[model samples]
Target: MPDTPAAPRFRSGAGRICLDFMRTLRLRGMDGATEELDTPEALAAWVAQLGPYPGGTKIPAPAEGVLGEARAVREAVYALLTAARSPAGPAGCPPKERGLLNRAAAAAPPVPVLDAAGSVTWTAGDPVGAVLADIARDALSLATSPALDRVRACSGPHCAAWFLDTSRPGNRRWCSMETCGNQAKKHAWRTRHATATAI
Candidate 1:
């Protein structure tokens, strides 16, 4: 049997579901970007892995066009958030994309369910649509909330990831300290040593 490809790791540092959804765009550092959610099965798997889903709950197969819709929604959310991060706030989501999100938001809204521990957790009746709705809602909230001011794109060259600056001084510039931050530190250290040796 062929080995199954590993699922893309979803980064949650963006501090918002919508931003995390946008991170699904693979190879953000490359010219030829890959689509992480490339198929219906991938979409189903993503939905199953979302934080709200109960463990072992069998998600229904996505209907035809659902994958396309998901990609469309993802792009729309990306564009809107990118614009919002700019000095000038986003003009707003394009009409067609907004309509797509609104429709999804209206269909199969997530409901809070009580888990075995009696804590409230959300679940959607139609997993795909519900996930989209939750993402749409989160995007809208981020666009309108004060948290918009805290959103920052990674400073690493070739990296296009965004993250929320939740640090005390609010000066964070990388998607992660372990990845881009470390790379930058190493590069600076090498440059300093090279200059010292030449001198």
Candidate 2:
């Protein structure tokens, strides 16, 4: 019998970007590839890299003289996620601030890559910013009353990563299972074993 091909995993665009941003923030620099504070092209490339595409995906030519705009887009999403966490005081943003957020929300979706013969080829349909918009909307939707807060950063002391908690309790913490939760369990087990040995 001939082998069947594996099914393509469908991932929502915003979900991928949200995970990328979380991964970037958690590691800061050394752990993963992210935007550098200096250089426009590098920053733009970093933003582009956030897309979940295979290496064969062809990137569209960068827009002319709009590196600043790309940077603004990245920062805008960052601000929205940050603001969503703090509802009171200076947490709520003004109209001018929201203008950028809306721009990012409405930005064009990522283009598909073409083959050498100019035919349509493999592609990543979702853009990073688009995913952030969806994540923010869904994150906020969980709130049933004014008392229910929207959005939250991971409470793990070493990791301040953000995540949308759709749990019934609305008390989720760790950003990912492979990272914080596993680490916490390992730490607990070691502590328990150590105490038993000491006694």
Candidate 3:
């Protein structure tokens, strides 16, 4: 029997919590858009993978209302950032999006706990909401700072993701070298090979 393939997991390393969260709606504003956070359990799973929670910690799935709120927060982050990256800058951030971010940011975030074992773990009364708050705060900071210039939309033809250009030269592209980057490289190679063979 063929070996079972690993599951497709959430994308990360976007350089900001909010940016990473924004990708939960993969291929946003593009064809084949996929909603990865379609369920409350999926939101909890995202917190486990992306939040400051410790490994093996069980995050309870939020209620339907909270799930809706989290999705709203994610969209707000995306819209706010898109506007901030524009020529109009942060001023382009709409009042509705700004207010949503403000409310989300006001919520309590995960509390850090230091143990005698020299390990730190995070806890929150509402883990999902806490993670949302963290994302909101991060979005607010990124949208207004000079670092906004470093945030870039992926160059992948079909990818609607964004990532921070942390390279020294600020020429980084693609959301991940393992995914979109690899696909782009393969495509380029195939194009070159096809041209060479034709000639």
Q: Give me the candidate number with maximum TM-score.
A: 3
Candidate 2 local lDDT, 34-66, one digit each (tens)? 444245444334444544345444445444444
Estimate every model's Cα lDDT from 0 to 1.
0.78, 0.48, 0.91
- On lDDT, the leading prediction is 3
Model 1 residue pairs with clashes? none
1 or 3, which is superior by lDDT?
Answer: 3
**TM-score of candidate 1 relative to the true fold:** 0.84
Off by over 4 Å in 1: 1-8, 27-30, 86-88, 115-117
The candidates, ranked best first by lDDT, are 3, 1, 2
Better of 1 and 3 by TM-score: 3
Candidate 1, lDDT over the whole model: 0.78
Cα displacement (angstroms), candidate 1, residue 104, comes to 2.3
Higher-scoring candidate on TM-score, 2 or 3: 3
When 1 and 2 are scored with lDDT, the better candidate is 1
